[model samples]
Target: MGRKRTIKRDTVLDAAEQVVMRDGAARLTLDAVACEAGISKASVLYDYKTKQALIKAVVERRLAAHATCEQEVAASFSGDPDAAIRTRIEVASHLLTEEDRAVALGLLASLAQDADLREPIARTYGERIAQVTGHSRSPRGALLAFLAIEGLMSLEWLGLHDWAPEERARIIAEIGWLVDQVPAPVSAPASVLSSSPERSTR
Candidate 1:
């Protein structure tokens, strides 16, 4: 008889995450994951057929967790289209756990190795931008705000610089102010609205 499936997939994925976090993504192997999970190699294979498959699963799981957090934040705004952008800023400014940061680093390593791994992240960003523009009365202002926030985050993620806590707080506050600065669409002047082309006579 075939061996029964006993280990949960989340358990295996969590083990894989830890392995990636500790040893680096390049060093992750079935044996390493099996040791981390305290499961048989066959059990690991049962859940994940190959290392590439496991890496994909890790990306999916991380993305899913992120989506859940974004959804929760959006829900707090009660259907506001701008909620996602606000939520992103909130999340970025909040203190990140070592585990969260490790997972991000792991994902980056995976992305470096496989460009395809970035598609899900790209798609999520695209969706969030669409939502930001859709809700803002001024699409350009919203886009600018979004780009500015992304730039700050990229700096942190790339280890380019670190700001003091007070500096970060000030920056977040300023970004929030910028996001709220989206103005309502302008209308034509009264004269323009009332004017009509004079009848052309030969």
Candidate 2:
């Protein structure tokens, strides 16, 4: 009934991600993560009552990591939402480091296998999309921008950025133009996730 300690939660989650990425979620075992994390198996069980609980923690952890960056980008453009958005897009584009690509792959792979991940994953994106609203840019435009950004993440994660750099650049560049067509911007970005500065690069 009491709160689980933060260290235990993190240790278990860390172990879960390692297991999921290396062995796949279907084969995840509490003992495996516990051993990998150098903690007693009971420790993991203590934080996560069940295998499902452990998986959720892992998924949430990964989601938060990505969310942290987006929040950062959002924080950069405090007053101008369009400029903030442009900055957000630019920062996201810049964040595609090799390590990020790897982490993204793991997080994505886990999400695909765990249905529980669907809502949080969708919510993480939906919240971001919600930032841009109204008729100036139909739901479709916002959707397109979201998808384009996702695609860019995918390509960059796969080390295929050069495969379509120009195409990607143009699409991202067009985000600014689209922002102009839209009405007032979203509120001041609360964090740097809105204005991430080139985390991923060639």
TM-score of each: 0.81, 0.68
Candidate 1 lDDT, tens digit per residue, 1-202? 9867679999999999999989888888999999999998998998789888898889889889978987776677776656766777777777566687677776677787686777777887889888888876656666777888888877776566778999988998788777767566788787775674653233
Count of backbone collisions in candidate 2: 20
RMSDs, each prediction?
9.1, 12.3
Off by over 4 Å in 2: 1-7, 107-110, 134-143, 157-171, 181-202
Q: What is the C-alpha lDDT of each candidate?
A: 0.80, 0.65
- Over 4 Å off in model 1, which ranges? 1-4, 79-81, 182-202
Give residue 155's lDDT in candidate 1 (0 to 100).
75
In candidate 1, clashing pairs total: 0
- Candidate 1, poorest ten consecutive residues by summed lDDT: 193-202
